[model samples]
Target: MSYCEDTIKKMLPKAYVRKHVAHEIYVAATHFKNLVPMMDKYVYNDGTTKDLMSLTGTIPVLFNDKTYNIPICLWIEESYPQTAPICYIRPTREMMIVRGKFISSNGEVEMPYLEEWKNGECDLVTLLQVMAVMFGDFPPVCIQPHSEPEQASCWLQFQRQAEVLSKTDGSFYVSLLREDDQPFQQDNETSC
Candidate 1:
């Protein structure tokens, strides 16, 4: 086992990994040779210090009868499985970070599947698959990454997005805002 593999095994019990395929998820079912989970921490709004591990991967999202690889981050925390991993779109300097009710300007994310996490039942695979399906409604787009330091912040991109969302005929913006208020449904399992 490599360093990441070893770290994962330490984070989660070996017996549990064998039984639940947690190890498989770390490797994305052999699709990825290794998972480079960066050691990080997140302080949530509730004054909680969440120990976070982030890894980038492409999730096949079905949209318009086609599939697209959505570049995203799987932010695993100490309370994973019992709590769903926080998902974030890996934005390039050119990619406009979509700030919706569920998606924050700083790449914080909340999706229905995550809210529906059930201990010992839902794992990373199921959650990712669900996000892939959910993304059909909101297409992902990216631009060329700017080399300038000033344009590197996702917040600047969000400001630009907010401007566009504020313009009249911004029905799209309203929809996203509405979705933020909507509750995550536990029974909504219609992922392709």
Candidate 2:
């Protein structure tokens, strides 16, 4: 049996056979298909290994009434169905967070849901929900346009990080994954 066929059997409904892919790696090339006609522009480029599944996408998140597309990734180990996927948000250069319990600039996540991840009982959408809550709390400290000489003492910085961590919780992450209808115009002259 070909590699593509084997991979599809193990991780189908997400991946299709593609000999033309770069390096001949078969990946689930599209976003989860409960999406719309035009698919609302999801920007995830992720795939699976023989015993692993990974997803990397810049998902749009709304916090404080503002939207930010954050780069996120998750790796589901071969031990899934009983374990959670290791997940994290790729930090942009303009952002930093020194005070997150389950978050870091290096994409290390210690979220509770992930610890409680269950195979056949959990999935990407559930993972997205956890991320939303994490983003809302720490929310990626923005880079300043100008440099300031204002120096913060260690105590002050530590205190700030602590404050941010205190409010962090594993809630409000999955609210963003919605299957809304996308506006599409059908060409009346063409048919599939």
Candidate 3:
């Protein structure tokens, strides 16, 4: 057995029902090698937390002739297979989540496939395929403009200054300082 299979079996050791879940996870891992299976804590909106199996990695989304690997996390509940896994788009520091019809502002994914998930019929591989297709049509994330390390640092500093100015004064002007000694004006005049 592969490492992923072993991990799934160990993490989801319930009984006969979980066997199917293990199989599904193993299949998904085989299909998407980039995704790694691990056990993690999932916190519910009601302040309840549960240790659950999760797959964290990227899914390839083809857009405009280029492929972009979109980072994502799939949290499988104990009652998975019976219920759909809670999915989220986990963007890196250099990326920003794009709220769209399929993805929420917080990166939570909601679609017809997940909404109408039926046990036995729905599986992880199919879910991932659907996600890829949907994301291709409407990307859930975009690469942040300030990708360079120096620019990123300048952006952070600008944000900090803006926050301080906002708290101290009602109106403030924010601009990002670039390495070329040019001021990237975000706004001419802004009131907090």
Worst 10 residues of 3 by lDDT: 183-192
Query: lDDT tens string, model 1, 70-138?
Result: 567886665555667777876544455556656766666677667778887887766766666666555
User: How close is every model to the real structure, measured as TM-score?
Assistant: 0.56, 0.49, 0.73
- Model 3 residue 82 CA deviation (Å) reads 1.0
lDDT of each: 0.54, 0.44, 0.71
Task: List model 3 lDDT by residue over 48-163, tens digit each.
Answer: 99888888988776644446677899999877888999999988775566676788878999999999999989999999999987876666664454445645442343344232
Superposed model 2: Cα runs more than 4 Å off: 1-52, 144-192
Residue pairs with colliding backbones in model 1 are none
Model 1: lDDT to the true structure: 0.54
Rank by TM-score (best first) = 3, 1, 2
TM-score of 2: 0.49
Clash count list over all predictions? 0, 3, 0
**Pairing residues by index, what is the TM-score of model 1?**
0.56
For candidate 3, the TM-score is 0.73
Give the per-residue Cα lDDT of candidate 3 at 108.
Answer: 99
Full candidate order by lDDT, most accurate first:
3, 1, 2
